[model samples]
Target chain A: QQQVKQSPQSLIVQKGGIPIINCAYENTAFDYFPWYQQFPGKGPALLIAIRPDVSEKKEGRFTISFNKSAKQFSLHIMDSQPGDSATYFCAASRFNAGGTSYGKLTFGQGTILTVHP
Target chain B: EADIYQTPRYLVIGTGKKITLECSQTMGHDKMYWYQQDPGMELHLIHYSYGVNSTEKGDLSSESTVSRIRTEHFPLTLESARPSHTSQYLCASRGGNNEQFFGPGTRLTVL
Candidate 1:
């Protein structure tokens, strides 16, 4: 079973527009959520992250809006640029300090975002 | 940037060949993970380790085996390569903040 589900496998937006990618998880035990960005032929890089305690978190042009009750979270990119085109992934994990499962993340299906100039 | 490294960024092998993918990290993290990803699909965790001398299989059932003899090294090996094994393998290590840092993936092609 896929622990987390992401919508809109691909997205296209103009350079000044905003692109939103959403994800939902079935496990309530998930406490940490993070987003990653990947270019072609490269590994995914940490874009931003959020804890369930806060409703939202923003870093630069990237924002994460998390809804705990609904078990859903979305990433919004403000003032999208052509360089922002890449694959985005959402991941979730539960805290397991000193345990075997510690820091293991369950990833959602990736979203291919394309920004046009 | 995460100081993680993966060797042989790309590999192609014939059937029944034995192969090992190398992963190393200089971040001094206790947790390391191996994930498999196909084109346009989600990443599946195949193996993970919490610390030196500790290893565990992840949710996905894989034919690969992993060893974590040292805190900085985690290697995955396949006894026999098959065409079905063709995919990208990603290595990651998690620090105290619980955020994972990924290395440049190794793209494997088995014939």
Candidate 2:
């Protein structure tokens, strides 16, 4: 009954290498897709997000490629550094407007990424 | 960083003990959520609140209970903790733009 599925439970890459993590969802009601990055001892922080309206979003060295029709998305880190080593999660939620409904998220199985210096 | 905070970053208690995990947000947001995650695993929603006095169960079924007595404070209580309940609990708040901000999380271990 998992709604969102992510691949590559763990990954290792050398410094300056690009690492990509992929995810797919089964629910079409999902309107917003977001990626979260978590350090070893900290809470997850929003790295990047995209709406179904767009095909891709780029923030700094992070890029999110989204395919609405396919219900798939992937995260790409360009020229990754050792500091980029962490766990990444992809989440989806249906958008509700007018500030009445709570937008609960459905998260994917996190991917642990390690960048060797 | 979000203004969300969770108290007792790490807790270890005996089984059958009643415990409460505290969560608070200073961002004045109306929506708050609680998520449970395993070590290096995905996050599963346990509960969420839209505003004061409005609480709802999330997609994942959980044995814990949550209360939203105030807009800024949401506390989760486990009446009888068990070893199976050991996991990391994350508290989050949502702003107008629907972006969620997570707290540092509480890692609980029931022995």
Candidate 3:
């Protein structure tokens, strides 16, 4: 079972447009949700994150929207630029039985985004 | 950037050979994990270490083994390489609050 599900295996958007990627989870136990961005031949990097208590978080051109009741969340890239073209992954995790989450992430398959200038 | 490193970024070896992938972090994080991934797929956790001399298996059943002799280094070993083992392996370390630092990864090809 895919504990976390992400949509739009690939996305194409115009520069200056807003591109949104969505993700949903089956497990309500998950309390932390994070997004990662990966470039060619590089490891995934933390972009932004949010918790169940918060509905939205913004940092620069990136924002994360969370819906706890729906068990869903999304990443929104404002004023999308060519530099934002990369693979994005959504992940969720719960503090394991011992309350040690340790960032053992359960990730989505990933969404590849391409922005045209 | 997180100070995680992986050696031999790419490896190609014949079957029946023994291979070890090295991973290290200078960030002084106590939690480390190894994940196996195929092209364009979700990563599968294979092994992890909570600290020096502490190790555990992950959700995926893998034939590889890992060791954590020092807090700075974690390495994975495959006793005998097989074609099925060809894939990308990712190493990650976590500090407080479950934020992980990841390495560039090692791509292994077995023939």
What's the number of clashes in each of the models?
A: 0, 0, 0
Give per-residue CA lDDT, model 1, range A33-77, as digits (tens): 999999888888999999999999999999999999999999999
With candidate 2 superimposed using the best TM-score fit, by how many Å does residue B97's alpha carbon deviate from the native? Answer: 1.0
> What lDDT is reached at residue A77 by model 3?
98
Off by over 4 Å in 2: A97-101
TM-score for each candidate, following the candidate numbering: 0.97, 0.96, 0.95
The lDDT-based order of candidates, best leading, equals: 1, 2, 3
List the candidate numbers ranked by DockQ, top first.
2, 1, 3
For model 2, residues B48-103, the per-residue Cα lDDT tens digits are: 99889999888789999999989999999999999999999999999887799999
Q: Evaluated with DockQ, which candidate comes out highest?
A: 2
| Native contacts present in each candidate (fraction) | 0.77, 0.86, 0.60
| DockQ for candidate 1 | 0.75
lDDT of 2: 0.92
Residue B52 in model 1: lDDT: 88
Computed on alpha carbons, the lDDT of every model, listed in order, comes to 0.92, 0.92, 0.90
TM-score ranking from best candidate downward? 1, 2, 3
lDDT of 3 by residue, A1-117 (tens): 437999889999999999999999998778889999988777888899888888999999999999988889999999999999999999998744254444568898899999999
lDDT of 2 by residue, A1-117 (tens): 338999889999999999999999998878889999999878999999899998989999999999888889999999999999999999988777444346777899999999999
Instruction: Point out the higher-scoring one by DockQ: 1 or 3.
Output: 1
- By summed lDDT, the worst window of 10 consecutive residues in model 1 chain A runs over A95-104
Residue A74 of model 3 has an lDDT of 98
